[model samples]
Target: MNLLVTGGAGFIGSHFVRAVLADRLPGLEGASVTVLDKMAYAGNFANLGPVAESKRLDFVPADASDAPVVGAALRGHDAVVHFAAAGVTGIEVLLEAAHRLDIARFVHVSTGDVYGSIDSGAWTERSPLTPTTPAAAARAGADLMALAYHCTHGLPVVVTRGSDNYGPYQHPGRTIPRLVTALLDGRAAPLSGDGGRVRDWLHVDDHCHGIALALLEGRPGEIYHVAGTVELTERDLTGLILAELDLTWDHVTATPGHKTGDHRRALDDDKIRRELGWRPRIEFSSGLATTIAWYRANPTWWRALQSE
Candidate 1:
């Protein structure tokens, strides 16, 4: 199959690209894949290094917002994996990709943050979207637009929102890599507000596998929540990493965080599990160990991108 993937250089995008090319998808051996990315500060080409010269992979440095560029690239492709757009850049780019791409399926990659924070219960598929960030707000608009295309233009579109994912090739500025960087450097890893905020963490490999499933198996106009099995607070999560390092909580130190994001964030994956028979394969503890090992083995890959 020939697939067009946007944001192919970013963490999750690159993971999906590698999976398809490495023939992890059954009956998809030797699949031809194209990666379209803007290579912004967050979308680094280094993430794509492993697949850069693969016989089945191609990289197109283009913005998804440019209609003609994306449209021309979409021609004759089996599907459009739209993982592009600013994770925090907001909805404008989301609308642009939908308008341009015409393919069998437009798998819109999204985050669970669009549901905002819930104090009492988990958000099901029918939960009202009350996003608190500009990025989530824009994504809501983008999700609605993709659904509209399914209804009006008869485009096969599926939207999947998942929790924060961590694994190899993740940009160092993100939470997991930041913590790993500090641990490796013997520096006081930064934590905000005593690490009270909680997040549903998924391994990137699993999350991208869910995306691949959504592209191949999902029905049009449906929404899927690709979540992992664990939800832990920043404090406990940091403590877990410290334990792996044979250190204590005192080894880490407190730092302030952006006041706007959620104090607790998690998503409900029951719908995806029931409908698609998909759930995270990597357990939280194993995922943590694997992530730590990945950082340790590939220090040069991550350390070069460390923040000042």
Candidate 2:
């Protein structure tokens, strides 16, 4: 099968590409992949270094918003897995291009943050979008646009709302990598508002696996939740990082956070598990350990990104 994966050089996208090339994901073995990436701040060529020699892999350094470019590259692909963080306009163009190409499956990878902050109970696929942050609002808009394509145009599309992902190749600005890199440099990691904001953490490997399931088995116009088995607050997560690094609270610097914004989030993944038989396989502690070790062992990979 020929596959087009946008933002395939970014953290989660790169992981998905590597998984497909390694035959780790079901239904995509021996597939040829075409990657369209903008090579932005988070997009790095080194992320695909492991699969650099794969004959099935093709790289296109371009923006997803470029309809002419995307349409030309998307031809003859069996499916499109969009992992790019293109705003509403870019998604519209890409979805149109994919629809015109008659792609078999268009999987739009999204985030749990689109549900905003849920004080209690996990957010199901039917949960109302109450985005609080600017980023969340933008994602919510994109999700709506993607689903609309399926409803209004009959373009086959499936959406997966994944929880916070932590693993190698993640940009250093994210919570886990930022803290890990900071602690590695013997610097106090910055914490916001007593570090009590809650997030469901899913390992990048598990996230990609869930997306693969959704891509292969999910129904059109449906949304799936790919969530972690465990949930942790910012304070709890920071504490775990400190423990992992053998540091104390003194190594953390608390900063003020939003007072009126949503502070907690969790997802109900039962639907995906029941319908597609998908479940997160990585344990949080073990996954955290492995991720920390990855950053520790590869300083050069992340050191240059720290300034950006």
Candidate 3:
């Protein structure tokens, strides 16, 4: 199958592309991929370097908001797995283009952050979106637009809301990579507002795998929650990173009054697990260790990004 992936050069998107090329994702073996990315600050070509020579992979450095470019890119592709966070305008552009082309499947990769903070229990697919941050709000808007295309135009859209993802190739701007890189650089990692915020950390590999399953088997106009193996508070997660790097609390500095948005996030992924048989494979301890090792070994990869 031929697939067009927007934001394919970014962290999660690039991981999906590499997995497809490597045949790591089941049901996607031998599939060709066309990556459309604007190469923003978070988007890195080096993320795709591992599979750069694959004849099955094609790269397009263009904004997803460009209707002409997006419309042209949609041609001759069986499906589109959109991972770009280009907000409502980009999503509309892609949906319109996909509608014209009559694409087979449209997997709109979303985030659990759209559900905002949950004091207790987990959020089901039926949960109402209550995004507090601008980023999550934008994603929620894009998600509604995608579903509208499916309901109004029969565009066959599937939305997958994944938890926080951490693994190799993630930009340091994110929590895990940011703290790991900072600690690795022998600097104090900033802890926000007592570090009490909660997040479910899903490995990028597992997150991409869930996306693949949703793409192949998920029902049209449906939303699936791809949950992580564990939910951890910022303090607990920071402690793990420190222990892994043989650092101490002395290396972590608390930054008060800097916290914003949801203080806790969780998801009930029973729908995806029961319907698609998707579960996270990587454990938190091991996953965190390997992630730190990746940053340590490849300073050039992240150092350059941090310098920019």
* TM-score to native of every candidate shown: 0.93, 0.97, 0.98
- Candidate 3 lDDT score at position 157: 98
Q: Which candidate leads in lDDT?
A: 3
Highest TM-score, which number?
3
| Model 2 worst lDDT run, 10 consecutive residues | 254-263
Worst 10-residue lDDT window for candidate 1 reads 86-95
Candidate numbers, best lDDT first, in rank order: 3, 2, 1
Return the lDDT, model 2, position 123. 92
Superior candidate under lDDT, 1 versus 2: 2
How do the residues 100-135 of candidate 2 rate in per-residue lDDT, one tens digit apiece?
Answer: 888889999999888888889999999899888787
Residue 244 deviation, candidate 1, in Å?
0.5
Candidate lDDT scores, in order, read 0.80, 0.92, 0.93
Model 2 gets an lDDT of 0.92
Worst 10-residue lDDT window, candidate 3: 254-263
lDDT of 2 at 51: 100
